[model samples]
Every structure is written in C-alpha cells, then in structure tokens.
Target chain A: MENVRVIARMDIKGPNLVKGIHLEGLRVLGKPEDFARYYYENGADELFYQDVVASLYERNSLHDIVSRTAKDSFIPLTVGGGIRSIDDIREVLRAGADKVCINTAAIRNPEFIRDAANKFGSSTIVVAIEAIRQPDGKYMAFVDNGREHTGVEVISWARRVEELGAGEIVITSVDREGTGKGYDIALTRSIARAVGVPVIAHGGPGKKEHFTDVLLEGKADAIAVASMIHYDLIAQQQSDMENRSEGNVSFLKSGRSSFGEIAPAGLIAIKQYLKESNIPCRN
Target chain B: MSGKKIAIIDYKLGNLFSVRQACVYLGYDAVVTSEKDEVMKADFAILPGVGAFGDAMNNLEKLDLISPIKDYIRAGRPFMGVCLGLQLLFTESDEFGSHKGLNLIEGTVKKFPPKKTNDEVLKVPQIEWNNIWERADRRWESTPLGSCRSGDYMYFVHSFFVQPQSPDVVLSVTTYGETTYCSSVLQGNLFACQFHPEKSGHHGVGIYKNWLTNYSNNK
Candidate 1:
C-alpha cells in the first residue's frame, strides 16, 4: 500500500508569511523561510508556497526565499502563482523548487502545460485546480486565487490537464479555504477519481479526523495543512523561547495555545492518529 | 578521477540540482557534467535523468555520451542511476515508442498493467509514496537500499517500469496492482533505482551515505 504525503501550504506576501480568508484580506505571519524550515524539519512530506500577490504584481518574488530554504531543506518544494511562461517555470526550478504548480498561467495558456511538461518532464509540473461550486450544479476552475472563473468544470478540467501532461493535480476548494470546517470531501473525491495523476487535497481542515477522511474517503494521495498548524505552532514555539529569556511578548502570543503546543507538534499527533487508523504515513 | 568527487551525468533531461544538493547535504562533493571524459574519469558517476526513454537516449547520442558512459561502466567504477537514468541502462524501452538503450544490462522497460486482477484501476505515472521491499537475498545487503527494510515509503513518479531479464540482477521489488516489478538492481559495480532516492527525505539521504561509505577506491 502507498503512504499518504502530508504537505504544509504556506501563503507568502512580500517577505512575510500571510493568512487570509479564502485567499483574501492578507495578514503577515512571519518569514516564509522561517515557516518553511519549521514545517520541513517537523514532518512535512513536502512544502507548497504560493505568493498571494505574485499574479497581482506580475512577478514571482519568492525566488530568494525558495533558494535559501532549498539549501536548508531536503524535502520536495513546490512553488505556484504568477507563473506565466515556461521561462518563469525554469526560473522557479533554478531557484531550487523541485516542482512548479501553476493556476492562472495554465488556464490562460493550456498549451503551456504540454510545453512545460515536454521541456521539464511531467514530474516537475503540477496543475493547481482552484475549484468553487456554483448555482449551475457544478464546480468550476477558478484562477488568480479564486478571483477569476475559467468556466471549466472541475472534473473535466482535471482530465484535460492530465491529458495535456500535468504530472500532478492540486485540487483546492475556494469555498473551504481558511474556514477550517473540514475538507470539501465531495470535491476532492470527484477530482481524485477523475485524474490518473496524484491529487493533493487542500483548504479547510479544522480537525484531526479530516486528514483520515480526505485520504481514505476522499481518496487523496496527499493533504495540505495550513491555518490549523502555522500560527498555533509558530506562536507556541515563540512564546516558549520568549518566556524563557525575557518573560514576555512574542509574535504568536495572540494564538492563545502558545508556550503549550507548537505547530510541528500537531504533525506528530496527526501522523500518529493516521497510523493508528491504519493509514500508512512516512516513517 | 583521483578525487572523491561524484559526477552527476546530465543529458539535458534530468533534475541535476536536487540530486547534487542531496549529495552536498550529505557532505559529498558532487558535480553535474555531460562531458565524456569527466564522467568516465570521476571516482563515482551518478546517472540522474528524467523524461522519456527515447528522448534521453537520443540526447545521449547527440552529446556523444553513449560510448563514454559504456566505457566508464566497463572500467568497473562505482555507478548509480536514478529514475530514467536507471531505465536507460537496459537494452530497450517501449515508452511512447520502441527505443534502444545502452544495453549495459539485460532488460526491457514496459508500462504498468492498466488494471489490477480484481478489476481495481492501477494508476499510470504512479505519483505517490510507495514502500520498496527488498528482494530476499544477500546481494541487496550491499546496495544503497541496504539500510531500508520492507515497508519503508519512498517517493515514486513514473508511467513505465523496467523489467530485467534475470531475477539475479533484481535487488528490490515494489508492488503496483497485482504485479510486482523490479524496482532496484545491483550488478556488481552497476547500481540503479526506479525511484528518486534523493527526494525520499532521511531514508533517501541515508542511501547516498550508505553507498558512499562503502564505495572503495580499489579500481
């Protein structure tokens, strides 16, 4: 049996790690590398960094951060957003990202997927499907972080991209983003079933059981965790270190659980829960 | 040739940096080169490749690397291959179309069975974390996977898998669908794995360490 990969999805805005409701209202968390290093060292099978403003600004600015993190981390790194051309993909890869995930550029130029896959190999390319449900009774692929509607149904788009040579498909739920209610299991299940490539389920996981459900019931090859782990863990670690030296203020102090349980700590907990539930995780 | 440098062969179709960085992470001095002399002369040569078999073989020919690589292997130096690099060691591959390989080992690569025996779908380009169990034997005890026992997960992404002629050369096997195919092989100084050990986290880096630690300069 294959083991499920656990990924940490971190949003980057300028130099700080940011969090927003459904990819909106950006708020800086900390340094991108700081969160990336913490996640990789803890048990993150892979890391997903999407620059929230990359497409808006028309430039992928996470190059330096990716290069620095690549030197320190050994796990697979994926960079997405604002990548408009094959040259942009090369630049990201040269910056030490193992794989490039594209959304807007891919929808704008579907042929770009085949071209990139042909040039860089399928494994280096990932098609990120930002899906949101509509009144027409179908999930449509959204671009620019759920800002633009491509009008392509999620399942059919997934199949089309796979045929076009996408090595993997990342299915993110716009409706579930940052809500922490649980995964959009129905959405994940459909796309996972539709595509031959591995599907990574992203957005909305507030509980430990969601990981098991999305993997087993939804049949996702990997699950990306964000809101739940990022702030809590970083704050907790910061509080511990701060309370140790100065006995006061910390960056993650408002996170409440600081000085108690760190972010990476949840990784071990969820991993253990998954194992106990008979789900094979990387040992 | 004299130094402890590890040469990573680049034929314009592989992730050379990540592999080199893995070795560098383990404190091994690694270099990426497509030059015939440098590759043949390195203390240890790591043939790391990605993409289709036909394209890779064609690129090797264009670079005039076919003979140099064969000559290097014949010299009995330690050589290890990753992914497509491993497949190119075979006599032939049926990916996209029939293609000729380096014929360093006796084998032909084939696509995975589209469906399992029980009617369950077997995904092509298996892009997931899979456990490569060691084939029961003593030969595997010497390869990079020596540290890994059965059921330890490693990352794998491929549409086709290599099938060797003789089971004697097979070092490890991974089950996909109802069939079990040869995943890793060890033929004296020649070693290769279907999965990317460089991206398999600690277990992956440990493989490089094991192979390097035991690799000698006798030749």
Candidate 2:
C-alpha cells in the first residue's frame, strides 16, 4: 500500500496554537512555531496553519505566523482564515505558504475557488469544508469557523469545490472534533468517494490506530489532526521507545534484527560460515 | 523574445493562481485577465473553470468575451481548457436543467450513471489517481499528453465528462468503473483535459512543458 500522508493541524487563536470542541472557544496549547517544528521533525508530512479567530478578528494575521513557521520549517505549510480575495490569497502564498485554504470566503462566493485555482493552480488552493452530520442523516457545511450553517449539503459542496478547481478538500467534522473517539469514517469515506480531488480528513483521531483506520477504511488521501499530537500521546510513546533503546536498534523482531544491538554475533558467524562454505546468504 | 506570456481567462469564478504558478514553474510570464485586449494580445490563452457550465458561460457572456475568445481560437493561437474549461467547450451539459456551453467542440457533458447496488455506491466525481490510455500509432504518444502512460495515474475530480461527436478529437481515455470516458481532447491547436494538469504534480508539469515547448512553440 502507498504511504499515507499525515498533516498536523495547528488551529491558532491570536498567537497561540489551540484545539477545542468544534470551533467555539479554543483551548490554548503552545506557540505556533514550536508546534510546527515539532510536527515537522517527528515525521509529519505537512502542516495546516488555520487562524481560527481571523473571521472574528476581521483580519488575516495568520499570514505573519504562517510566514514565520514556513521560514523555520521545511515541510509544506497551508494557511487559511479570513482569505476573502485574490490579494489575500496572494499575501499568504507570498508569505511562504505552500497552499492557501479558503473556507468561509469560498463558500460565500463559490467562484473564489475557481478564481484562486486558476490564478495559483488547483494544487495550491485548498478548500476547507467544516461540516457536521445533521440529525436527518445529511452532512451540512458550516462557515465562519464552523459557526454559521450554510445548509448546503456536504457531499454536494465537495463536488462543487472540486469543480471550482480546488486541488484538495479538507473536511473537518464538528461533532467529531477533539473527541478522540476515532474519525467520522462514514463522513470521510462519503466525501472521499464524492470528489475526484484528494480529501484531507480532519477531526477525531485519538491514536495512531485512528490514523490507520481513516487511511485504510476511510480511504482518505491525508489525515489532519490537532488534539492527538498536540497532547503528545502518540509522539510520547514513540519517543519513549526510542529513548529506552541503546545503539543501532531495530524494531522488527521476527527473525529480524532485535533492538539495542548493532549486530548479533550469531548472525555475523552465520554470514562468515556461509561465506566459507561457498553458500550464498542474502544480506 | 525569450519569455512567453500566457493569459488565463479570469471570469470572477475560480482561483487562477494554480495555472499562474504552473506558468511560473515553467519559467514563463503568466497573467490572469478577463480583459479582451489583454487576452487577444497574449501568446497563449488558457481557459480554466470549476463550476456549473451555465454559470461559467453566463460569466463569459457578461464579460463580453465570447467573440474575442472565438476570434483568438479561430486565429489559430494556442489554447487549453481544464476540467470545467473542457466541459465548457462542449455543446451543452445536463447540469441544472441542460445549459448551453461555449460550443467550441461537438460534444455533450453528462453525469456518471448511478451505482447499481444500494449497499455498494459508485464513486462519483471519480476522484483519485486513475490511469489514462493514449491512442495508438504513437501520435500523441510522444507529446506532453504522452506523459500519462497506460496505468500512469493522473488526478481526476469531476462527475460529468465530454462525449465528443468525432472520434478523432478524443486524445485520451480513462476508465471509471465500466465507462471509458474522454480524459482529454485535442482539436487542431486547441487542447482540453478533463484531468487537472496543474494538480497532477511532476506529470502535470511535464504536460505544461510539452504544451509550451512543443504545441506553443510550433505556433
């Protein structure tokens, strides 16, 4: 199977990166730059820097933050929030963001998706759809940091966004946000099946297993997370294992090399013995 | 003389940066404009869209660009249409009660048929890296369009597809379930692709290169 891309989401409020339930009143975590570096160093494929409060603040200060983080990190960065016009899109791209995500603006205008995609190319324009599953078994799109309900169907919007030349769609489920009860796999699979573009599943995901589930079952191209990595549950375990191991350790245990050893003398002896006997040993 | 200027038609619809970035990557001067004079003056023109075919057509009409665009294409200048751009070239689309398109090509755009089993849904918009088949005789087999070999995955994201009246115009074909849809079409100097070359990554870049170096250079 192809390696699934992992994206770390840093939903920022003011200067601090935060994560919370849905979009109402976020819980501050750490500095955006620090979290960005952490994710980049620890095998994250990309980083999403969303200024969650930009709509409320009525300005895009996230560009400065994204610029700072982009300068420091090597991985791809996507910046979203308060991106209302072509100029705003240009500002974020010029600020070193690899891609610019538009949620509320794209939903409000719909045409902005195509305009941005045409100007920047679809690959650089990401449309973030913050959706929630209605009680009537329909997924509806939300805007204004998932505060305002658009009443537009999520699956239809996914198709529309892709048609508008959005290179990717980032679907975040409000009901599943920060719940750590695994992703809304049904919602993700539906969205993934709906559009031709890559779908980045956001919200839920409490553990690495959740990531695997979304990638394998949900068939998501990319998984975006906040609470899982932010709290250091996943990273801490991997770090602990690394710290406990000595030099040149291998995790594979099935006839493979064991951890905390450069090489077992028995394996070396077997290699030498095979060489002396003119027997080929695959290295 | 050294650099080429590519104008992407801006109809106040989709974002135009993706194409501009692609042009920049190819080391060309690319601009997005809806102005007739600017478009007519460009060395190459790219019409890209992502919305209802009727809405895009309406915008093009409102901008008073229909004649200018037809003139540019008729002048034998290089032009390429992407996704909705490709759909717009068709005669009409079944989206939102049958809307007339730009009618540059003889074709119709229609949605994928519904899935058979209620439990097993057929994936619409056909989003993923699907393989595109090139025509035999090594015609487009050697061009930028050739980059998408059989089984070579190109990104796709759309429900509707172009059904060209003439087989000669069908440049490439991609399979989705039981249907082998038109992945791209080439008619004279005009080229259109259902798949997004900009989002297709290195393969997409190769396509742009071929368009610039081969197709665009020939003119």
Candidate 3:
C-alpha cells in the first residue's frame, strides 16, 4: 500500500540496546547489531537509531552502527541524537544514513530546519517531537531527553516543522513508552490530522495488534516500535518438529535394563526433518 | 550547442551534489556554482533548493547574483527551479510572516490550512509520490515532460504552495489531502517544479535528461 511504511527504532544508551519507561529509566536488553539485523530480515521498511546519551559525550557511536548496517541491509536508515548543528547532520548523512532527525537543535534554531532541508533536500530531514502529557491533559513537547518542557503544543509544532521544510515528523509519546500497554492513539491521530506531511508514530507499541491499531485507527502513516521485538516477547512463532519425534522407543532386548528416549535420535534425524519440512531451524 | 554547459546555482543551500549527479547520470556535464559569470555564461541554468522561500531569496540577494540571473533568464536561457527554488519565483511567501520572494513570477506562496477534525486530516508539507497532470498547451506537450501522462506520480515535499496570477503559466497539477495544487509551471524559458525530480529516482532522471536534451537542442 502507498500509505503503509514500517520503521524499526533502535534506542541505544551506550553500546547496548535499551528499553525505557516514559523516556526516563532505561533497561539494557541486548546488542544493537543483532536487533538491527533481526528487524532488517523481518520485513522492516526502515530503521532509526537514537542515542540516549548525554550531550557531553562528544561522540555518537550510532553513526558507525548505522553505517555498518546500511552496508549489509538494503533499506533506509535514520539517526537522531545530539544533532545540534548542520555539521553534525552532515556527519551522520555521510556515514550512510538516508535521513537525519533533529529535535532540540531545531527548536533552539528554527532556521536550522530550513537550512538543512535546503542543503539536503526535504526528503532527508526529519523533525522528532517528544510529547509528554501535561496536567491539563494536553500534550506538551519536551526537549533534551524529555527533561525540559516547551509550551508549544504537539500539533502546532508538527505544523511548524513542516512549514520550515521538514520532510517528515516523528511523534514519540513519552508517557506511553516501554509500558507495553499500547501507543497513544489520540496523540498520534491528532498530529497526523494536523500536518499534510507524513507522520511516524513512536513509543508504547507492545504487540502486532498495537501496530495495526495505530495505523488503522490513529491514521499514522508509519509506526516505530522497539521493546517488544527486542525482548522476543512478540513475533511469529514456527513449529519445526514432525510426526517422527512424537513417540519414544524402548531397547530392552540387548540390555538387562530397559532404556527409553525420544524416537528421533541424533543430529541427522533433526536435520533430515528440518530439510524435508523446509522450516528454518538453527542451533 | 553540442558542448553547452549547464550551471546549477549553489548558494550553500540546496542539494547541489544530487543535482550535479543527476546531470552527470544523464550524460551532461553540469557544475554547481554561485559565481555570476559561470551562471550567466551557461547555456542553461538550474536553481534548486529545499528550504524556506524567504531564506533562499536572501541568499540570492546576498551573493549579488540576482540581477545577473534575471538578465540571463531574460536573454532566453533555459532556467528551472526545484521545490524552494520553485517557491522563490513567487512574489511573496507567508512563512513565519509575509516575506518577499524573487518576484520573477507573479504569484504568492501560502501555507496549507490546518485540517479540521471532521476533515480527512491532511498533513502539512504534503509529502509522498503523487501523480502529475500535464498542461494541455502544445508547447509544454512538446518537451520531455510531454511524455508524462495526466497521472504520473512524482515526489513532493512542501507545506506552502504558489498561486500564479496567470493560469497560462501552469504546466502541471497534483492532488494532496483535500486540495489539488499546482506542481509545475513554465513561462518563456523558465520552468519550476514543486517536486524534487532529482530525488524521485528514475522518473526524476528522465525529466533531467529531457530538459538537457531540449535545452541543448534549442540553444
């Protein structure tokens, strides 16, 4: 379908892939390269890398990771985090990322969005909005890892970003992150309704159902998910055992004591079964 | 005419490399330049960018190449603008506030209105690949763009649009959200596209090839 685009997000907090709750506390899950390959092989349309490190790090390791993945994977990739200048954006793009997502830098200097878009073309510039629920039940934008709040409303910012030449806006819900509950459908729908540009909804997607819900109900053009897939709690399950392994055999004629075991013996039986069934089973 | 050069105006904004790369892929020797002499001396010129209308106009003015560019186009040299370059041809743009454009074309740039709840919720900066409808004019029909049918999909990425004072200038149209917008327009030797043909892959390359072929032959 023309409107369906799936993006897999890899949130990093050092060298490890991390999942967090409401964009605050994070838990390391596994290596990012493994997860990136898994997503790439499993029908992900695009991939995104966001380094959650402090701005003082002076270096972003995500660029190398994205570059390495792009070399092997045939899909578009985007990198975001600590992108404060045009030079930073250029560095990431040069490293083989198809697009660069800017947030705090864009808010601090609105003109930067226009400049980057002009230099790289709108297709390569993405505006990421971290939205948190406010006291009055309205969603407010947060910058700098969701530490500082901006009075700018989510929908308004989405509109402004597009006007400034941002080709796409990735709206992430800080409140629903890592909860495995589901995406904030209302927020995603509102932002999707606000802009004529494509909107990518991120955060709080726990299962395949959540993805369907957001795309069908929330009207999000694309949905970015990380946690559930990283933990292996969700994915398609396949069975490889055949009828030959259903029974056990007892050898009592040669031995004084009866010995029993699962019928299909050794690696040969398993390999033959797998080969005949044409199921992908790895050890 | 066989060895004519095409200059792509690069003012520290716009995808100069991609434009140059596209030209190279189409078997044309194109250079990205901000120099007036080079731009004016070229057989054809291309003004390509993806930014706010106001900032682009400012850069053109700052470089002191505006008058020279106008003179070159007036001399009947083929000129084309992509995205913001297309918007730059308008008289004014209402981004952040009302800002003046190059006034090369009689038109105004305005943002897409906010989508109401009951509406289909058209996103701003209408993006994605959409169909392009060709103009009925035989002159436009004779160019490489003439090969495109009424519903050929080209890539688009913009929120604001230009409304030409004269309908005779419009060469193509595209639909977005709830509105049907102008996608391309041409007047004399000048042509502007709201979509990025350079990034549109094969179709984009075809457009560039057609332009180069036509420009070289006409010269």
Candidate 4:
C-alpha cells in the first residue's frame, strides 16, 4: 500500500477562505495564503484550493492566490472549481498549480475530461466528484459545490472519469462534508475500488482517528481535510486573528471551535498519531 | 553567485513556472524558451514536461528543438529532464501508441502494471510521495541526488516509467505496489528522473543546486 497523502483543502470565496457545512452557509476563515503557508510549513503533504463560487460568478479568482502560495510553498498545489475549458486549465497551471480539478464542467460535458486530459497529461487533470447520499442509500453526484444535482451515480462516474483519462479522482461526500463525524467509508471504498487511479477522500474529517479510519477502512490513497486543520490553526492563534479585516470573522471571534462537537487537532499531531498506528505518511 | 545560464525547455506541453521558480530560488537566472540558440548557449539546460509522450514529441519537433537538444547533450553540457521530459529522451514510449523519442538514451518507456504480483490492483500514475533508494553501486555522492539520502521521499505523478537498456545508467530505483523500476538515471553530463524535483521541497532544490554547483563549471 502507498503512503496516505494528507492534503489541506482550502475553500475560497472571493479573497477570503471560507468553511461551511454540506458545502453551504459559507463562513469566512481568513486569508487562504496565510493558512496555506502555515500548512505547508507545518507538514501538509499537498494544498488544494477550490473556488467555491466560481461557477456562480463565472470566473476563478484563485490564480493570484495560487501564485502567491506557490512562491513559498514548494509542495504540490491543486486548484479546483470553475475550470470549464482548456484555456482555464492552462491559466491555472501557468499560475503555478500543478493540477486542476474540474467538477461542474466535467459533470456537464463528460468529454471535457477527455479533452483536458489529452491536452494536459492525465496527471495534470483531476476529476472532482461531489456526491450526496440519496434516501435509498444510493450515492448521487452533484455539481456547483453540491448546490445542484447531476443525477449521476458516484461509482459509475468514478469509473467513467478514470476511463476518460483522469489520473486521479477526488470524491467529496457532500453529506459528510463539514459534519466532522468521519468519512463515508462506503462511498470512498466504492470509488477507490471502482477506479485504478488513486482516489482522494474529501470531507467529514474531524479528529486524528477519523483520518486513520478513512485511510484504513475507506481505502483512500489520500485524504483532503478542511475544517479539522483550519479550525486548529485558528485556535492556536485566536488572539492574533481576531482583528483581521477580511471575510466574516464571526466564527473566529466566537472562540467556539469544534468540528462536530470534537475539538480539532493540529496537522503535526495527527501525523504523529498516524505514525504510531503504523500508517505510512510523510512528515 | 554561480552565474550559470539556465534554460528550461518550453515545448508548450507542461508547466514551466515551478521549474523556473525552483531555479530562481536557487539564485540562478533561468530562461524558459523554445529558441534553439538560447538552449545551446545555456550552461545548464533543463527539459521539464508533464503530458503524453506522443504529444510532447510532436511539440518538440514542431518547435524544431530536436537537433539542438541532441546537440546540447552531445556537447556534454549539464542537462536535466523531469517527468515526461525524462521519458522523451528515450527510444520510444508505449503511451497512447508506439511513438519515437529523442533516443538520447537507449531505453523505452512503458506503463505500470495494472495488477501487482500478489494479485492486488495497482494504481496507475502513482501520485503520492514515495521514497527512492540508491541502486547503481550505491553511488550518489557525485550525482545531483547526492543531497538526498536513501529512502528520501519525492513527489511522483506519472503512469509510465522508463526502462533503460544499460543497467549501469540507473541511478535510483523506486518500488510502487509490487513492481520496482528505474526512477532516475545518470550518464555523463545528463541526469533525468521520473519524479518532479521542483515540487519535492527543499532537498529537491538541493538537487538543482548540487547539479549547478558541481557540473555548471565543469563544462
């Protein structure tokens, strides 16, 4: 088995970093660049920047953020959201992103994945599947940050993306996202087993044990974490970040930080716990 | 203070920013270009790419960079290739279909196996950070990878790997799933790796610095 990659996922809305439950009700965190540099220095294996409202705005404002983050952070950077055409992919790559993830565009026209993969190697293209569990226990894919339904099944979509030449897949469970209970193991394992490419499990990570569970039981090659690490960073310097002049800082000001009733742990501590459990991960 | 000219080859198939930024971070002025003259004049020329093998060859040929690159290497200038750039120097690749390469190195690029020997399904395009161990005589003290110790993890994102015909050229080997293949090679003034050193962090930068510090003035 390969070492599980722990990626710090930052959801961006305009210039401020935001977080929400089920990918809705956005709450401003802080400058993503600050959190990105912190994560890179602290031991984030990779950085994932997703423009949450890019599809709604019809433009991606992550190019500046991506370039600034890439300047100091030398790790792999992946940017997602609002990537609709080849030019959009090229612009992000030129802005210092190593990979571009397509969600809405990929769901709208599946062939776009093939074209993007063909133009920019499969390794450069990542198909992000936003999935929500249906009432009948079937996982259905969603688009636009889980704001719209695609009526596409998650497992079959994973297989199709891999077949279309996607080098990697990021299957984010909308229902589990931001809830911090744990990952949807069934969703992760199903997609992981459905595709030969590496699968990155996103959302629903609250504590250190949750990461262990997702990697061991979910069979995810990598895990994309947000609130868990984000809240931890904010908690460490709550005093310093209180006066920041960007985004809505009400969540930070409240000083009541918890991911689904459990306090979040720092990334370093999480990696230490993973190592003690015999799970391979880069320090 | 090395003052060595660095040219990152731009075949229009991959991101040249990270490679150039890595070079700039090392205090060397790097130029990303397709002009043959710029490439030939550079003290250190780098071929960095991330795309299919067939498309890369087409772009290189379209830009008329084939002869100059071959000449640059023939002149014994210090050269480095990353990811698809490393694969492009081989004889041919099995990606997409049969496609000829620069043939600068006697090798063929092949895809990773779909399944391991233990009947476990293997993931293509290993995208995780995996460690590399010294293979050829355990001699890394003089190569660009000298700064990195054995078992140092580097960022890898590719499905196909190169198989050099000459075993002596193999500098390092990495095992993914059940298969172990050549991860990097060093021959004369040329060094290439399947992993992206620019994205590999500080030790990776140390690689470019070592190559520049040691081989830059040798030419």
RMSD of 3: 11.4
Checking candidate 1 for backbone clashes, the offending pairs are A233-A262, A233-A263
Top TM-score: which candidate number? Answer: 4
Error of 2 at B2 (Å): 3.3
Q: Please give the distance, in angstroms, between residue A220's alpha carbon in candidate 3 and its true position after superposition.
A: 2.5
Candidate 1: list runs displaced more than 4 Å. Answer: A242-251, A257-265, B1-3, B217-219
The deviation in Å at residue B190 for candidate 1 is 0.6
In the predicted model 4, the residue pairs found to clash are none
Q: Put down candidate 4 lDDT per residue, A5-57, tens digits, no spaces.
A: 98999999999999999999888989999999999888888999999999988
Q: After superposition, how far is residue B43 of candidate 4 from its true place, in Å?
A: 1.4
Which residue runs of candidate 4 sit more than 4 Å off their true CA positions? A239-253, A257-260, B217-219
The digit string of per-residue lDDT tens for model 1 on B133-189 reads 875664456567778877777778788899999988888888776668888888988
lDDT tens digits by residue: candidate 3, B35-87: 99999888779998766666777888899878988898788878998888888
TM-score of 4: 0.95
Which regions in candidate 2 have their CA more than 4 angstroms from the true location?
Answer: A1-48, A55-58, A64-79, A82-181, A184-200, A204-208, A215-222, A225-283, B114-119, B123-127, B137-139, B216-219
Model 2, span B52-153: residue lDDT tens: 677788899999998999999988889999888899988999986899988889989988874633444454545545567876733676456865555555
DockQ of each: 0.59, 0.06, 0.15, 0.75
- After TM-score superposition, the amount by which residue B205's alpha carbon in candidate 1 deviates from its true location, in angstroms, is 1.1
lDDT of 2 by residue, A103-132 (tens): 998888999888887676666788998888
Lowest lDDT sum, 10 consecutive residues, model 1 chain B, at B134-143
* CAPRI grade of model 1: medium
